[model samples]
Every structure is written in C-alpha cells, then in structure tokens.
Target: MIPKLAILRRSGLLTLALGVFFLYQSLKLELGSWNEPGPGLWPLLLSLLVLTASFVLLIGNSEGGAGSEKKPFAALLRDSRLPLAAIASLVLFIVLSRYAGLTLAGGIMLLAWLRLLGKEKWTTSIVVAAGLTALCHVLFAVALQVPLPEDWLLALWSAGR
Candidate 1:
C-alpha cells in the first residue's frame, strides 16, 4: 500500500504538470506591453502563479492531514471522491467560462467549492461568491482592463441593446 504522504506528493506532481500546461498555453498568447496590456498578460501571470504554488506544494513539508498509514494507492483513489469531484467541478468551470463570462462561471464555481467542499452555510457561500465575483470583475475587467469571456446572458443583453 502506498503511504498517504506519497499520495500527497503525487497530487503535487499532478498539479505541477497542470501548471506547466497553463504556462505553455499562456506563452502562446501575446504578452502585451505594459499600460496597454495584451490579452496574454493575465494568463501568463496567473499560470506563473500556478507554477509557483504547485512547486511549493511539491516540496513543502509533510502535513498532518495525510495520515502516515501505509495503504494501497487503489484504496486512496477509491476514497478520494470529494477530491475527484472538485477536479471535475474545475473542468466544468472552465467549460462554462468559455460560454459564460468569468463572473458567472467563477461565481458558480466558488459557490460550489465553498458550500460543497468547505461545507460552509449556504448564506455564507452565496455572499462570498457574489462578493468574490464582483471583486474579480473589478480586478480583471475594470482595473486590469482585461476582457473576460461574454456569458450567454450578457451577450444576449448586449445584442438586444
């Protein structure tokens, strides 16, 4: 059986791979000039952040949550439904974002993560999700002048105007 620590390490490795992929994709886009930033700037920065975090996770000290008990990896995989679901939710968020703006997708994703994964109260989850979504819009769309994907609802509204 694989030790819990090993599983954690493996997860870190997986994260690292994902981070690398993001970085690579970001590199393909134009990393615009400052003041008149290009679309790629945000993605590039975000991907680098992911890379850094994943690297830290990979090398970080062993934590208490992952038990020291030696168990088969299969068992670990079988017992990781929540983690798996979280991952799936992330994929959903991405797909949703492609059609719906980040505000909507991010709100839904944040709400799910907070309420389901964090097991927070629904009111708390809703409040946080709304606040965070607004904050994200202000940061990315307003402050940074980054264009986010147009959600169907927003697109429809604009078309009607």
Candidate 2:
C-alpha cells in the first residue's frame, strides 16, 4: 500500500483535476453579469472553491509533518469509522427521502446522526431533530414552495380522506 501522504497527495491531485474540469465546464455555460447571475455563476464559484481547497491540501501535505506513515488499507478504514458512518447515513437519507419525503427522512437522519454519531443524549437528539425537521419542512415546502415529492404517508392520508 502507498504511504498516507502519497495517498493524500494523489487524492489532492485528483480533486484539483476535477475542479479544473468543473471550472472549464462552468465557463462554457452562460454566465450572466454580476447583477443578473446566470446558471453558470454558482458552479463557477463552487469549482473555484474546490480548486483552492485542493491546492491547499496538496501544498500542506507536500512535506511529512504528521500522519505521513504507511499504513494498511484496513487500518485506514478502521480509523475512518465516523466519516464512513456519516456517508452511509447520508446515502440512507437519500434512499429514504425518495419514499418518505424530505421531512420524515430528514428527521430520521438527523435523529440517527445526532444520537449515534454525535453521541448526543436521546432527548436532546429527538428534540433537535424534530425541530430541525420542522424548520426544514417550513423553509423548503412552505416558504420556498419547492414542490417536494409526495410522501407515502401523505398519499395514504389523502386516499383515506
């Protein structure tokens, strides 16, 4: 296996290349003036951010400061449990959202993440999750009128009515 530093450098290079690709694609899109921002502006800005961060990561890890030793891939996976869990939970949320709608899926995701990953107390996690779910529902569904997908529960309720 490659050294951790080498892995990081390679990842940084990959990210930098992706950012450059995104920058090129975004530039090809129609970017309106500063006052009337077009579809491309947001992507362009995000690509720039990615480019900058990858550049910084590459520069910072150029020399061995810390965590530069070679370790097995298994060890790397073992050390990244939290991040892996977060990613897994995010994927779960995405799958759940398709069926459960944003509100319910977001609530479940928040509760699980706060309680399991964040190690928050049950009451605190439940309360915060519910609150955030409500806030998100109001923000996107009510205020922004985002036309979220119809939840199975909502469909059942309407059917019963």
Candidate 3:
C-alpha cells in the first residue's frame, strides 16, 4: 500500500494530466474575443485553474515535506478517507451528470462534499451548493451560451409544455 503522501503526489500528478488534457481539448474549440467569448473560453479558464492548483498541490507535498515520511498502515488508511471520498464523489458526479445533467449532478456533489466531508451544516451546505450550481448555470448556459449535457428535468418540462 502506498503511503499517504505518495497517494497525494500521485493524485496531484493525475490531476495535472487531466488538466493538460482538458486544456488541449478546450483549445480545439474556437476561442473568441473577450467581449464575445466562445464555447471553449470557460473550459479553457477552468483547465488553467486546474493546472495551477495541481502544480501547487504537487509542490507543496513534494518528497521533502513533513508528510513525506511513511505512516503506519492504520494511519495511512485513515488519512486516505478524504481522498477516497473525493474520488468517489467525482465518479458520482460523472455518472449522475449523464442521467441528471450537470446542474443537478454538480449540486449533489457539492452538497455531499460540503455536508458529509466538510462537516458543514445542512442548511449552509444546501444553500452554497444551490448557489454555486445556479451560478454555474448562468455563467455557462446563459451568459456564455455553452451547451451543457442535456438536462432530464428540462427535457421533461419541455415535453410537458
């Protein structure tokens, strides 16, 4: 079993790779001027943010850091809970988005992380998740005119109309 710090380093590396992939994918799409942002602009910015964050994580937890020492098996297991939860949540988000759409999936994931992982109050978690989801919707779908994964709820509503 890998030590906690090694796991963190590997995760950082994985994130860095993902960031690079996203950046490349985003660059394939048209990147319009700032005043007239294209569909790819938001994704480009997000990918850049991911790259920056992953680099920070990698540098902060480098081999020489205090957390680099090998920990006991039990301690390593305990320390891995957060990272496992994050990975699980990411999987959940991907699967859920395919069925429920990005807005709902994002909201659910955020709520779970904030409430269960972060130990935040239910009300606070719900509010923050909802707010963030709404903000994302407005920014991506409304303002930037980016096409998101088809939303089941919206489809149902449209069918009903």
TM agreement with the true structure for every prediction: 0.64, 0.55, 0.60
When superposed on Cα atoms, how far off is each prediction in RMSD? 6.2, 6.1, 5.9
**Candidate 2 structure quality by residue, lDDT tens digits, 1-85:** 7776676667667769978998999999999989999989998998898799677757766765476753333243333245446
Residues 9-102 of candidate 1: C-alpha lDDT, one tens digit per residue: 7766776787789889888888878887887888888778777866665556245455554334434343334555677898999898887767
Residue 73 displacement in candidate 1 (angstroms): 21
How do these models rank on lDDT, best leading? 3, 2, 1
Candidate 3 regions exceeding 4 Å error are 65-103, 121-161
Candidate 1's displacement at residue 155, Å, is 7.5
Model 1 error, position 11 (Å): 1.1
lDDT of 3 at 39: 87
The TM-score of candidate 3 is 0.60
TM-score between model 1 and native:
0.64
Judging by TM-score, tell me the better candidate of 1 and 2. 1
Candidate 2 yields a Cα-based lDDT of: 0.78
How far out, in Å, is residue 60 in model 1?
A: 1.6
CA lDDT scores, all candidates in order: 0.75, 0.78, 0.82
Off by over 4 Å in 1: 62-90, 131-161
> In model 3, which range of ten residues has the least summed lDDT?
71-80
